[model samples]
Target: MTYALVRPARLDLNSYARATGLHPEAVRRLVALGLLEPVRDARGELCFSPAQVAVAARIQRLHHGLSINYAAIGLVIDLLDRIEELEADLRRLSERH
Candidate 1:
């Protein structure tokens, strides 16, 4: 049997936002909303990933293009997260089926 691993390098919030044309505060808000995850170092400063920036950019698009409010955004993000988790679980189950 073979295993698969997916590992991405860490990025700082400023760098991530700069790469994706997003504001660090926007990404920070998303992290507070649980829509994005940011790691902290020994000093408790937030660090982001490139992929996290991408996700934040997409979220920004959704809000801008669809006029999504913060409350609605939070709900949608939560639902989408659950959907993704469920899909991953389903894929794992299918692999053993």
Candidate 2:
């Protein structure tokens, strides 16, 4: 089987902030808090995945809409990730049976 490789577009800090409608400092804080993961490109500048824009947008809604603190937001995100993992596992197990 041939595998198809798909690469996500990477966004620089300013572009990411613009796309997310968040301030640069807010993105920096998210990176500092380990909520966002940015990797260095060939130029050694920090860049984020396009997919992370959606994640940041979700966090923005949770922070502004629900007034949730960053720590709680982290926990909430983690729980949601766990739920998705469990659901995927359930689906796989059902398919195997």
Candidate 3:
């Protein structure tokens, strides 16, 4: 079987911010806080995957809904991701029986 590798389109900081409906500075702050992961382009500019738009929205919802600081947001995101992974593992284990 031949598998094709698909690369996602990358967006510059401004585009990412616009897509996420956030200010560029807010996106930068998220990058600084390690909430968003971006790649450096050939010109040393930050680029984000289009998929991150959803993540940014989730972050905004969590921040505003819970009224939590960015640091706490990071922790919450981590826990949510861990729970997702555990749930997937549980599903796989059950499927094996």
Q: Clash pairs of candidate 1?
A: none
For each candidate, the alpha-carbon lDDT, in order, equals: 0.78, 0.91, 0.92
Q: Candidate 1, residues 1-97: lDDT per residue as tens digits?
A: 9665875577787887787677888777777778787888668888776677667776887788989975588788778889999999999999999
Pairs that collide, model 3: none
Candidate 3 RMSD to the real structure: 3.0
Q: For each candidate, what TM-score against the reference?
A: 0.64, 0.80, 0.86
Residue runs of model 2 more than 4 Å from their true location after superposition: 1-8
Error of 1 at 69 (Å): 1.5
Per-model C-alpha RMSD: 5.7, 3.4, 3.0
Q: Order of all candidates by TM-score, from best down to worst? A: 3, 2, 1
Candidate 1 matches the true fold with a TM-score of 0.64
Best by TM-score: 3
